[model samples]
Target chain A: MTGRDGGAPLEPLGNTPVVILVRPQMAENIGTTARAMANGGLFHLRLVSPRDGWPQDRAWRTASGADRILEAATVHESVDDAIADLHHVYATCPRPRHIVKTVMTARGGAAELRAATERGLKVGLMFGPERAGLDNEDMARADALIRYPLNPTFMSLNLAQAVMIMAYEWWMAADATPPRTLMTNETHVATKGELENFVSHLVRELDGCGFLRNEQKRPGMVRNLRHFFTRGEVTEQELRTLHGVVRELAHPRRAED
Target chain B: MTGRDGGAPLEPLGNTPVVILVRPQMAENIGTTARAMANGGLFHLRLVSPRDGWPQDRAWRTASGADRILEAATVHESVDDAIADLHHVYATCPRPRHIVKTVMTARGGAAELRAATERGLKVGLMFGPERAGLDNEDMARADALIRYPLNPTFMSLNLAQAVMIMAYEWWMAADATPPRTLMTNETHVATKGELENFVSHLVRELDGCGFLRNEQKRPGMVRNLRHFFTRGEVTEQELRTLHGVVRELAHPRRAED
Candidate 1:
């Protein structure tokens, strides 16, 4: 079953390289970070001054089956060392520090990074230790700062969450086709028109069964139901399946009713 | 802080009802289900027919911080026995069967349940065995059917994810207050006038930096950047902070240069 509209194949961008981690604090966070990275097809894992060193047990345990990342991870001793071969790098920070350059929000950062990667530029994202975050000197090493609008009261996001947000945005922009079906396609099991027809039929059957006792209340109740179904964008196959069920219920003894 | 539009306080609805699972299979699934219920503040837990008995060590370990739900869980035998005094009862199913007068999506089901509860109705959501969801006989006793929109290719969601989606939507709508911080009684940060000023300033800054080198490309770039910032409805404090950074960049020190 596809979308309510005509179903179209989802196309997502397949080629985007990512550089991750700089002096990460916890192994579990690194594992989760890898999972988030893998979610968007980002494969490259770079580590700098990890507290527990390479192949840490805690990191693998937290990775939750994203072992490929741990196996492929490249370790470094410094931020500069981590991205020495990269053509471009972007550092994430919540607020302005001493760095004097154009800062971009995560959305903007993703756009710029995608453009760079499309030109075959090796782009890296530098993160700092969990406790104090990236220092001002670290921010100065990057060409751009990636920022996000967060709740001021509590803008401190866990390292993995921050990575996920950036990765998600990059994936959304670079991949023209969605990995998962959006609710906009037409190949769905039932379209809005089909659902309305089925609902009409179902309501008539209910009326015949004398299930809707109050005549005035029927319209409101039916309207509420219609509103509910409309929000879901029921597909064609689902509609047909539902129609078959309703038919059987309407005619209890009929074969294939 | 409150909604950016100066709305009323947004707080959770306390003392939301519990969902009881009877004879559920799989400890991992139960933990996930508990997490889902917790996502939307529906924290009461009751178990009946669990493959493993009450206070299952596996269930608690899987539940993460949702141990509260496991601790508060009550046990029951039959469906009727579980919800005997409840004014409203909903049974979740992927498709319709012989039972259920009203069919609703998880969102609709949760909304209705919330309203009923507000009106002092004791509401209960029931789930049958995992291998086969609620049976027709079991569904027949419920007041309504809660349906979820899912991909036909893989409609089977781990029980908890299903619960989370419903709970999150219910909590979001029921709270009634927006989740943003309000600026003042009548106006919030980034009023239309302020947004306009920021756009003008940003454009000027870009032009000064020679980033707007191409005359034809200027409008599109400026428009895109403006659209990005405006979507966030930048707060007054945020604007002030941004202005300081822009000023510093526009007039950098010789040592920094």
Candidate 2:
């Protein structure tokens, strides 16, 4: 659909991550996975010896309007050949393979994939068929194991769902920032100098009042004082208010007249 | 499927979230949604006045082996009746409705749902039809909007894929930890007491060196110093090294040496 404003760009953002499905059984799932990939802006697909064979009518029908992805999908006889040109490969393993491997959550894995893409390196995410997940040999060839913290009692995830999560995370991580930006009314956040000055003033006054008695702990105390004001985005107005509050508190009382 | 441990319990984990299809039209999408739900361990499906009548043969066939979910499905004449008992309701919206609402990603939404499940509250996720998403009127009834950051160019996901993403996220968030645990053997992580003692010692040394000049700023500084050490899990060996470093730095130089 076109953007409501009618000026939205027609192109999707970022490089597409290659999705490799190994020994996938159902045509419907491959279609759905393609649909899901297209939904999240990923288009490159590689099928490794699909059980039902390729070019199935059912996948085309189920893919809805995502015919481009299905048409572009490449079929490979082996996992090695499918990811031969890819610099980074992630294997989604539902169960632990009893071997030592670096494990990452979907979010973490996507971040790494985004980084790889930024360096112009090809990246691929591999998924096993519905029944058995990636074999040890398949996983041994991958860079890392992408594991979800699924409920122990029921851990099975649909093949498409697994692909969708990784794709969504990759899209989000590759973006400039989150879509929704807080409306700040044209006011820029307070500068580091502004925050530092206010914090230093506050600390100096507190020190004069014999607040910081532990002389040996001055640096850390100052840093802590600095952090309190800098932990969040300090607005211009808020910074002024803090400066005023500090001056008022540290002011000497001339007997109330 | 049996667990790798051989005697793993057969019961599904967590409460079954209600999947309410609000005005869903396609029989295939509904069937696929059932299959996706079953894949992620959700069984309580409530159809809110589907365009096609309930007990759809297509949905059953598409559901693959998830016949139990279809057999247990419930149909309601209206959205109100469908989610009347649900304490929390999430409406999946593909586009911005231009109305004020809390928006969350699938991951955040799932975490909230898992928390609600722990509280024993009835939780329901509602999906609109394929073409036009939840209208403003339909969205008014929802507590929050579940938004996925899809590519602007191709932002549509298959209804079942949408359902599957939400379900998968819920399952992941409801679990203990990601499936694979990094092997951090032998050396235990530093205890809270160890961290606190180290921070105190460091702070005392810094204070003596005239670093923490501000008295009132001491508490915040101490907290920040402690935070720096405890931000990540520090091993026992690392903590011991930190202690030795602090002691050595604070030591007074001997004239003979």
Candidate 3:
């Protein structure tokens, strides 16, 4: 399936679960976070006692075509209520709390969450209130802590921005190896057989140039030359260029001779 | 200089030119754009005719600790007035206009701008009003246009998001390799020497097991074994595990035998 943006194909999330927000404050932030989630092809959203509003007009206005997310946002009274059905719950925190749970960086958390999701586990990502954020009591509900490494002094990230960062990382993990468009126009690297041919050609050129005066040492010298080129992993274009150089040396002009 | 948030040291601009937006429309957007610029350490914000507030109240609020940007904002009037002393001026546009000198992608434009900046040339990024963006007339003032690759259905992006994307690409260019911290922690593959040692051990174990009875084909067998391991790029940990298996095979326990 094509991504919403169409730059790449959408990666299917076989069983990845929703993101749960525990007491999000601003409607605009909710809207933006929803948009960010949509941008990364994450569809599920759950809100717990959002401060300003839920099913908010301002949120709908700011959602900017991500109304589908707003339409599907599940509302709950408390953090526990939001993640009651989840097999795994990850709470986002700036710093570590005294919790006996797996602690992962945002990237690591996303990766693990994605893996769990693929295995058909219901996962939830919990965010807290805008101003004060999640309390220790709220964090007690999580199975893991997702910590973002930011400047300690200025660690406050707007809700949507945080969502975007996590979502982007999840998207990247889904396609860990970036698809490389091969340079079809460029000469392909020579195979082992081609390298052997090039070595033989080079040896003949060296003999013609009187460089291999001693036949016994010629084999050793040729082996060393082959090792040098092999280590370089010379490309087809490079081998072609080397062939030209060898031809020139073997059949030199009278002036050079 | 320290960032306005007074956190980590800001990435140095070296000689990258600054793009000053005069009379920008939204403060939140300005903040977003500033964050974008900060992504690549693109210092020098010159503002003129800001809408919500000068020194950008909303901008700083949304900048997420990029206060140093607000501290460094330089206000200006007309487009020419903003970049009059600068050697190069790149204007951003959603579409190419016949009147503009040239139109380029944010990536292409950034590459050119970076080159010019590296040569100690002053470069300015011109952004027009939000609702109308840069008019063909206003865009004429710039040397080239920086266009973003967006969905054709909706080419528009909030000013800050657009800025952030460009800044991100520029930052990636500044460091061609991913951050060192981002490297995977997988075990190192065995080196040539290590592989040779493992192969010798494997051959001895196989001989002890009477697996290789024909000594005449030993050289070919060894070559084949080397090829197999070389193709796999066995890690040091994997080799150790393999060595244990080989030792077990060579010196079987009395019960197992």
Candidate 4:
């Protein structure tokens, strides 16, 4: 028993962006970040190369009731692997970068993420390490930048602060009851990992059939193909179908050896 | 030098709401709340009857660089004294009260507060103790209520989270995202894979127990079972618990394995 709904269990809010922290330092910040995310109604968390490593006891201690997010959190060795399953990704930085991408305020970025989730796209919001924030290399990979509009003179934002602002916006932008929620939840949309697997499978098939005969342009061709599919939302069943199609195309049924 | 504003003196942002913590328990949280407020560009802080009294070193130490806000913070003996000079007041509560008052989202409330201040009125946003939030008497005194659009099922908000949200909203003032609708559930819905895994586990256990021995009806029984659980929302933790249940039932341990 806890409060008015004393016996009720705590569950995370669904269909929000995947909050990815890139190279985060300090276990306490990660823990506090989880609490902030939970408060703002965000659930999914991905950590790319946490400095002290995952399963830290300090993080659990600080997370309070939000240890559930930490328990379900997935750890990635690289940013690419972290966002492989996502269709859209935005990076949160404190300052402007030289990249030619759309820069959005916290609310604007959150609205965009919410709209994408409603469209069935799995989106991610990435934050850089506490020290220097996101580098240009990481900035180049993101579709856009989410910059919090803090006071110009006193622009002091920690990891938890940045996450909570977006989280608040994400929660507010939602219609509370989404129209496509049931279908989206039921289909159990293919994760970026699943989609990536299918893409790699298709690329391998294309390579075997000489579809990209020009070696110099193969990487660009492959990139185009991946983007074409990555931009679309696919369900688990759809990925299975795509995998089957690629398998059949690569190995004809005429010789089932 | 911090970011691009190194070696520059920081000036407080103008026209933001006053933050009041009523009967706050921890001094460390008071410090962190000041930091959260500063991050969101709000500086005015008022404490009402702090549990351990004022001038807490723990609070100043935990405040990071935000001790300036704490230094300017004023302490009052009661809630009325805290908001005596405020022209408008909004209590941040997690739940709806029996008292009839306009319930505004955090953003909406912030916008309203900004408009009031712009009209040359003092405004205060009050938060209750960490244990049980604002009481009915305290809530009844406010001009309106500001409830965050958090997940209804897991609406566990702390003092710092509430302060940061109001501070962020008041600081932005330009956000146009419509506010005030809260999501229904707290439990995170299980992904398709997690659901499928649970179904497969249950079906396998049923087979082991000879529950699906009938040749013609086995598929129908499995279908019915899957549909029964699939029709409802089961969180990831719930699914894990279900998996454990099936495992235990299939091979019950006599107290221990």
Candidate 5:
């Protein structure tokens, strides 16, 4: 029961899995958790009885620039109300206590959440308090448990770190490893012919300068030199620079000067 | 030089890449970096001139039981001195300023560093100061760069979280990552320094030729030019080819003949 929202109820952030912090104590941790969620592109935040109570001044300060997530967060009276509308729920727990649920690694849980999001299901990712993790009663509410593969000897993950890692997994599970795109949008990628021309231009200079004078190694050196430019998949702007670079080195600012 | 540890130098903890924080600011951040390293099984920690000074009471307190790592951590006067014993190095830079190095995703980088480690190479994973990240000069020392695939819209990872995720990926890399390259190759890939030298040489020639004469726009143009070359992942042989190409074009048979 969110007491403040008047007659209407707060809704889950569409498609994205909701992050629920149950009885989290410190404002700093909550703020950092919200920041972590934003980093992983998860927006919805639901708090179940934060110990320091709601709208803590310090919380917003700790959240860095993630003010929007904290601003839209809904407070819940209980865990049951927190996940009331969710089609699926995942509780993050270290493996030893995962006897009751269909235990999955964080990676496995991320894939499950990704699938649920694609199917348009309302999903909840629950994290317990800073002092004590989810109680047995609270853990029982989840459909499955996410056991992060942490070091067995030093299993010391803070509340924000756990949420951050889980959120990272969620983002990574859905994301295709992006093909390396040239960061600048201004220039078009160079054509194969453009690259060949640049390579040929440089080779011609090498020949003239006697840099490629060794007959035994000339062809191999030429091929290797060509491969370097070809692999960059140079942009038109870069190729232009290269062409100019060759011309200038052979005959410095001869025209512009 | 670690002033406190007299006689023998503080050596890194075996084959794992020593986590080097370049001028990290706060005790809290340094403490958390150690904690994060512990969580992911990374043992070595090196501080490249921590601003607040070392052995701070607040750091160990904030580390939250990651005391052993903090205790054994070594402080260095410079980035080079910190990475002196390391055979391979990686710098993490997530944004548009990346230039003159092979760029890799955190996952991809973790696998690579892991391979280098398995081959008995001591490695270094470098992070920059909180307020300002690594300078281009500092970046020039690395074998390559590690760029985390963060949510592009909200890519605000703190110092400790950055180290944490990298450490997590390092541990995850042992079995989880697929092999790095699809093609068969023998010659070693060029290090960031080698790649950077080629970029600087070409840029100088471009400058001499007046290709980058637009003073107001030179910085961006230089960055773009470096990016074009860095993206290629040129090998040692290719780098040699490129050096010859640059030399031949600049001085030409006009000099050598």
Candidate 6:
């Protein structure tokens, strides 16, 4: 696939895990799921008895240019046939089942999948339908369960979002680039000296305006003020902007427009 | 909202971090974003100059019972008014803007937001429109940039997925329970005594089979075998199952069936 900005050809999305959607209901959701998978670099999508049937127009409409996934999707009759050839299988389940199975967070599961792929093992990640997640029989077929650490009170996740989370984790684990770096391209971070100078100037102006009342409590107040600014990790440019803001706010307006 | 299982009433979804969508273009996307936020226990939805305008029927249709988010949503004419009172503001930006700012991954930004909430600071997470992301002026207003570690080639993410990621991280960080844990509800972790007994039984069975043929490496071989099973923190029932497997394998020719 070409990049969104028409850059170099895009690397294949998730290649290791064959994402099997069991009895997915909504075509739009299936489409979104495909898009999510593509976003995470996951390609192979298998469906098991979709409620609305495959080749739905809405799925393509919602897929938003990721129809390649849908077009290449394989439909299956049962979960057994879906993962019959896979060496490692993970069921994305939220509730506990009757059987005993290894459970892993998405991160741990991705790491385990990576190891399996390195050993030339085909892995499948199964997701149940949106209405009720994987049934007991479906859960029983998997080696382990992968559950997102969601708020217990509100454990429901949009199916595509769930797929996206797993895909994102897998992509992040595979990609070697740092997730983010401090935006230090244009200017340097403010030094302690610069921060202190700005804080001292503000304190002096505040004191002149009687903002720092009670001389005995002045030092503690100043320390608290300094702590607030320091916690923000003010950059040199931001500090200058803050100085300008302070100067404007501190000065009295003498009928100046 | 009641859970899918109709158990307990859900606590209010996101109350701390206000989600502000700037110049949103689509109603369905807005709806799904609401649903995603609700899935992550976030309810506060703020819209800044929505293109299709608020109270669209399509948004409600796609929200999937997350209309509460829309009903209580506050719409503003501008981003500044939307986040006027927030102490901490994070901009979810996929592309770099021509400005100097602090950059953090979604996980790091969530941690920072969690800390700010601990200090009773109100936080606002701003996301730009679908076509064009936040402009330089909008980025300038934010305290930090929350970047998702996405595939460089296919960097575009459906806006709701982005929101869901942040919400999931926030919920996980706030929740005290570990992300993934062994399914230990029915059985306790096998005690050392039980583990030792199983190990001894397994070793005896292996010895009878002449598996440890090399006398020089016998100790290391046994140690390696022990480490393999023990690493999983095998439960009592699992140990029993292993024992059954060993017994069946040891007497292969005596199959009664």
Q: Which stretches of candidate 1 lie over 4 Å from their true place?
A: A1-15, A94-103, A176-257, B1-257
lDDT (10s digit) by residue, model 6, range A85-144? 999999888776556677888877888888888888999899988878888899889988
lDDT of 1 at A252: 72
Candidate 6 to native Cα RMSD, angstroms: 5.6
Model 5, A4-76: lDDT tens digits are 1122222323578899999998999989998888778788999999998998988899886677889999999
Q: Write the per-residue lDDT of candidate 2 for residues A1-257, one digit (tens) a residue.
A: 11222234333355767999999999998987877787677889899999988899999886756678898889999999999999999898876644656778887788888888889998999999887878888998988888865444444457877887787877777655433332234354678888777787888888988888798998888878777766557666667888888787778355332
For each candidate, the alpha-carbon lDDT, in order, equals: 0.65, 0.75, 0.67, 0.77, 0.78, 0.81
Q: Give the number of the best model, judged by TM-score.
A: 6
Candidate 6 docking class: acceptable
Model 4 pairs in collision: A11-B186, A85-A192, A85-A193
- How well does each candidate superpose onto the true structure, as a TM-score? 0.47, 0.61, 0.51, 0.64, 0.69, 0.76
- Sorted into a CAPRI-style docking class, model 3 comes out as incorrect
Of the true interface contacts, the fraction found in model 2 is 0.22
Q: What is the lDDT of residue B252 in candidate 5?
A: 89
lDDT by residue for model 1 (B1-257), tens = 01121222222246465686767888777776665565456767667667776666788776645666677777777777778878888777665533314566655677778788888878888876666777777777877777654322223333564465556545644653322222233334667787777668877888999999999998899889877987644566567677777878887776476
Error of 1 at B1 (Å): 22
Candidate 6 docking DockQ: 0.34
Two-chain DockQ for model 4 = 0.08
Runs off by more than 4 Å, candidate 6: A1-6, A13-15, A49-58, A75-78, A118-121, A174-180, A184-257, B1-6, B13-15, B52-57, B195-231, B238-257
Q: Please list all clashing residue pairs in model 5, or write none if there are none.
A: A209-B252, A209-B253
Native contacts matched by each model: 0.00, 0.22, 0.03, 0.19, 0.14, 0.37
Docking quality (DockQ) for each candidate: 0.06, 0.11, 0.04, 0.08, 0.06, 0.34
DockQ of 5: 0.06
Write the residue-wise lDDT of candidate 1 on A1-257 in tens digits.
00111232222234455556878878998987875565445668899888888778888786645577778899988887888888888887765543345466665677777888888888888777776778877777887777655322223345765675566556655544321122323344466678889899889888998877799899898888788878744567667778889888888765554
Tens-digit lDDT string for candidate 5 (B1-257): 00111222223335777899999888899899988887777878899898989889989888867787899899999998999889989888765363434677778888888889999988889998886788888888987777776566666788889998998888777635221221214566678988888888888888887888999999999998787887645677777888889778877887787
